[model samples]
Target: MDRWAWANGLLDMAETLVIQQRGVRLYDGDDKTKFDSGTLLLTTHRLLWRNQKTSDCCISLPLWQIVFFEEQAAGIGKSAKIIIHLQVAAPNKESGPYQSSKYSFIKLSFREHGQIEFYRRLAEELSQKRWERISVPQPVPAGRSQPGRVKAVGIVGIERKLAEKRKETDKNISEAFEDLSKLMNKAKEMVDLSKSIANKIKEKQGDISEDETIRFKSYLLSMGIADPVTRETHGSGTHYHMQLAKQLVTMLHAPLEEQGGMMALTEVYCLTNRARGMELLSPEDLVNACKMFEALKLPMRLRVFDSGVMVVQLQSHNEDEMIASALETVSERGFLSSEEYAKLVGISVLLAKERLLLAEKFGHLCRDDSVESLRFYPNLFLTQD
Candidate 1:
């Protein structure tokens, strides 16, 4: 889990194991912080306390431990349906205790809450805690005879020979470093050589970098799904697997432009690598891909937001594409809020904000505070310059 730990366990939440259907709303008859009536979805993995109109965050619950809750729900209905009422109860928790009410608690006393059924469905799902422990089935079958799984036609695979070559190269490089260290600091010229190489490459350097990037991108595209990093090894043996893991991530960057000129670099990494079948990369490679794109003038960037989430931006992505989608979004909904824009773009709020900011600068969009940094239909922002 070193890969997981370094990436802030970004993958942990990636597969929450808990699932939901139909959102719920939370509202207060009169908003008060301490005493509220909003409903929360309690689960073996998390306490998905939520408001329907907005996304919900599932707070985690410990397994096999006793927890005291201010309240809990027994069942749901409008006319004072059954409630667990943990207001004065000590909750029992366990890791898949193979029984009901063995995991965690949810409190429903917040008066600001909207409805209770949302939490009710949650209770029903959690009551079957053993089911939640089961892994989601593979989307497609690998082949030949599997029950409860659709036969999947061939997952793509990357070249192991190419991978091994890369690995051997890496190993050689590592050994070279060790040997060089004994040579009394002869490595000082590495920086000068790299700069000299950069200078010598000049304009062509960008072209070559870009060309190679595109080449690899095409390679990744034609590439079948990557082999699991565990193909031979037990647990991802080294950093080389990490790079192979990032291939899908670098590959998907192009598609992001249409959404909003951006994507979460971390998310892109997760999704792309996931598509590659659980091979993964270090955050450093993710950063490197962003930098490579930036160096190539690909309108892509590694944005460090005030919120501190990192994202990849694609400036070259057509505004017409986003605006085209935006037109549909607004047409469907009357006006696109920041929340709606993100939904339309299929990206995070941080990326949505960057797209809005870029649009405002480019005259392709307009924003009002009511829209909360969201923009619509362009005006001539370019006229000032």
Candidate 2:
């Protein structure tokens, strides 16, 4: 808690907002604190929290202070949380809610349920080290000239410097894309350039593009796989698939979390290929790679449903939790068709039906196949007996 600093909620130069969540509570170590029910904002440089009622009361913690973090699943009567372990507080740390803490960590309880996506984005920011890239100008002493430095003093000088930089950037871009061979050779540089362009567009326009398809394509391009495992790179056969499976697990973790911990194999194929850019993966190769997910004991597994719908889901996805949620929804609504439940839950009709079938299999719900469509009701047999 001492690591936090009081702030006026103003972003630093070059800093940008990544994500935000409402109804979040900050925990001082494991104990409760007065900083309850606030909005948590994740930026490139720091994690800012402001009271929902009193917006003026805001505090921030630098991203560089974080050592690591993990998600704590929601439990009975408790909200989900992100446990952020921190390094020792700096000697010159700014004032915060607490002077000292027993534990070297803090928790952010997500009451409104956005921990998964927040965690994913947080991981990305940490891996990127965006804070280190931010070069804040240091104040110089009153009448001192810094050695080996020439500042752009006037408008013409500034314009000349900007023009030179733009010319160099344009030259680099042209050279990188002069031919297909050059583009393939400079793939890593291209990815970095793509991300920079996307970030600039997002900063100015709030998104890379207005069109949905274009926006999605831009997103995929921004998340390019710098070192994708390919047959040519790793050689063919079982060894190649094994390496491919490991890479897929790392690449798909965030996407799976965003998709409610499960995604259809076909959707994964499209996303993977798009992210890979030129190197596309065939359906057969994708299936072969996914089959090794279980054998390798990765965090995700490939499951082929009875209906032949294959999906990749996190191992932490609990069947009991899904069943309980479905049961509670059905109990509240009295009865729900698959389509109705899908609309309510914001999931596909196929997944909704699968959940309903699983609940029925567990005897928590009973299905009624009527003329209109199949509907499910709370299992009265379990309640009556």
Q: Which candidate comes out best when scored by lDDT?
A: 2
Q: In candidate 1, residue 228 scores what lDDT?
A: 37
For model 2, the superposed segments whose C-alpha errors exceed 4 Å read 1-222
* Global CA lDDT computed for model 1: 0.45
Query: How high is the CA lDDT of each candidate model?
Result: 0.45, 0.85
Over the stretch 75-180, how does candidate 2's per-residue lDDT look in tens digits? Answer: 9999889999999998878788777878999999988766776888899889877666553344578999779866556898668657755765686587666776
Question: Which 10 residues in a row give candidate 1 its minimum summed lDDT?
Answer: 1-10
lDDT of 1 by residue, 1-385 (tens): 0000011111132133333322222212112222122234444444433333433332222221222322232235422222222222233432221233321322234232222433444554445443344332323436755666543233322254345447656866998989979665655677678788678668675467776778866765556364533312221223433433344345665567444466777677775665555445557655655565544555455667565767765656565665555545554565556666777667776666655555555555566664354445444344355
Total clashes in model 1, counting residue pairs 3 or more apart in sequence or in different chains? 23
Error of 1 at 279 (Å): 4.7
How does each model score on TM-score? 0.29, 0.44
Q: In model 2, which range of ten residues has the least summed lDDT?
A: 130-139
Candidate 2 overall Cα lDDT vs. reference?
0.85
